[model samples]
Target: MLENLGNRFQDIFKKVRGHGKLSEENIKEALKEVKMSLLEADVNYKVVKDFIKKIQEKAIGTEVLKGINPGQQFIKIVNDELVELLGGTNSRLTKGVKNPTVIMLAGLQGAGKTTFAAKLAARLRKEGETPYLVAADVYRPAAMKQLEVLAKQINIPAYIDEGNKDPIDISKKAFGQARANNYSYMIIDTAGRLHIDEHLMDELGDIKKAVRPQEILLVVDAMIGQDAVNLAKNFNDKLSIDGIVLTKFDGDTRGGAALSIKSVVGKPIKFVGVGEKIADLELFHPERLASRILGMGDVVSLVEKAQEVVDEKDIKSLEEKIKTQQFDLNDFLKQLQTIKKMGPLGSILKMIPGMNSDLGDLAPAEKEMKKTEAIIQSMTLQERKKPDILKASRKIRIAKGSGTDVSDINKLLKQFSQMKNMMKMLSSGKMPNLGGGMPMGIGRGKNKFF
Candidate 1:
């Protein structure tokens, strides 16, 4: 999402590292470039100015200028400042002392508040919390229905007051129902408009007063740039929002709203909507995001994501299969599905150290995975278990069923053979050849992985 800004920062750091030593002039020149990059990224003018100023003060100090690695020291200073600009630490959702903590979501009509509500409920549900979705958006057509459907997808309960038109009344009743049912959390999806208006504010205020929510999260679209920051300020002025939920963070965002909102509006971004999936919501972490923006990658977050989707027992089973040479196409398909559950391949690659901005395009890799899945699905269980029995005629039939050329099927089989060979070598404590022995469609031929 912050690809451009991240690239610029990485370029600037590369130039700094190229120099044998850094002087005050070197620091000044780099900070000037950094300032321009932030401005070009659509960051708020005041926020950019203050950020550059802080870095300048820290970089020019004797502690940094005389450090053994001045370039690295300067980079650390910038990273620290970026973390502070991004809110210094993670802001957790508040849970009141009483039961059934209530959270109210407010934002523009298309800001993804409804979708984020479902995402949040899903996250809480995974945490062993009984979360109930309160469809209080009585204004937008089908808003309640939309929340209900999303809730059903995650197997969470949702309250919809079909007869009630008042959002405040609906929220109050939903809160009562949640409390009576002993739900751990009640997330109210409030109505929004094209823009902030007095009526919208009044209605939200009435709901807040009626429910007395433990937290009021203002959902801001990260793709809107500085407008999102201004919107946050306006909402905070009217409703005193507790935290921010930056939605569409996986879009082609310039990174302005994410960098400026916390500093300008004095609100911590609690969660970020990384994708459209109900499991795509991530708790916002300032240091991890700061590292990503600097092209440092976020290994901590990567490992956390892996832990969330990869089961230990499944891993052990897969390991035993590989060691026993019993892995088949079915097991390979299962591994592919598990990888898909971790989110997009491109986003996953960006989280690895040293793989930050180097991945040019990942479309081919994604397409290859989909094609492999199609071919495997087209094959029968017996074929997956025993690929040796398949001849040219069977290959042609499978290709036709999967809507691919026979050559594609050949390449997939070749790739699968190479993968199995590599696994065999590893299991036998031998190193596999890497020159011409690499998997087809991975780093060789026209169908590169990236």
Candidate 2:
């Protein structure tokens, strides 16, 4: 998401670390580059200026210059500042003391507000919260229907009134229905307009008064960069939005909006839309994002994602197989499915430390994974458990089935053997150093075949 900005910082650090001892002049030169980088990222001019000033004030001080690993210390200073600029911490939704805490989502017409409502509902349901969807957007074409369809997909009940035209009445009725049905949470998707106006603001105000939403979330498109900041400001001016939901965070924006909105609009970003999938909305963590922007991947988040998709029973079984050195193609395919369920392969890889800018590596690694999965799936049950049974003759058959060649089959078999041996070492508390994400027998050096 912050690919451009990340590369710039990574480059600057490369230069910083290259020097044995950095002088004040050297640090100033680097911050100059940093200033240009932040400015080019479309960050608010004042935020950038203040951010750079804060870093420079600390970066050249005697405390850092004389510290061990001064260059790394300087980088840490910059990272810390970035975190502060990005909201410093997460802001969670406040649970109402009363039943059915209402959360009203407001955004521009095409900002994906309706879809995010369903996503939030799904998240709440996953967490044992009985969240109901209120399709109060009666103005847009098919907006309420879209919400109903999403609610159905997630098996959550939605409050929709085809006969009701006033959003205020629809919201009020929905709140009453939530109480009647014992819903703990209610996400009301308010109607959006092409642009802010008195009419739209008045409607939103009326609905807000009717429901007294616990969280008034302003959804903004991340692809618009600083323009999103301006939009957020206007919404906050009228409604004093409690937080922000930056949609299309996985898009090709320079990440300026995410870095600037809190400073401009004075509301923490509560969630970010990482992908189009309903499961893609993530609770915003500013520190994790700051680490990501500095090319230091978020391993904690990666583990959390894996935990979400990996079943405990399956994990125990997989552990047994790995410990016994009996992992088979079946186990491998199951692991691939586990990874897929977590998220996109590329996105998952980016969460690993030092892999944020490894898109070049991930593309081919993903391709190899898919090809390996295909070849393994084509094999018979016997061949999967005992690869030695796959003689030259069987290799040809598997190649034909998988639309691959015998040579491809041979390479996969060899890699699987190496991986098995590697697993044995890992199980015995021995780890082969995989310099730079080159997993055992997977990249360069020994087993670069894959």
lDDT of each: 0.88, 0.86
Question: Residues 1-450, candidate 1, lDDT per residue (tens digit)?
Answer: 888888888888866664445567777778889999999999999999999988877666435445356667777889999999999999999788877999999999999999999999999988889999999888888998899889888899999887799888888888899989999999999999999999999999999899998999999899898999999999999999999999999998899999998899999999999988888899999999989888889999998988988999999999999999999999999988887888898788788766677677688789889988999899999999888877999999999999998898888887888889999999999998878436654553433662
Could you tell me the TM-score of candidate 2? 0.94
**Candidate 1 worst ten-residue window by lDDT:** 441-450
Q: After superposition, which runs of candidate 1 have C-alpha atoms over 4 Å from their true positions?
A: 61-71, 428-433, 436-440, 444-447
Q: Each prediction's Cα RMSD?
A: 2.7, 2.4
Error of 2 at 401 (Å): 2.4
How would you encode candidate 2's per-residue C-alpha lDDT over 331-385 as one tens digit per residue?
A: 9888877877888776876787776774664565667777888899999999999
The CA lDDT at 242 in model 2 is 97
Clashing pairs in 1: none
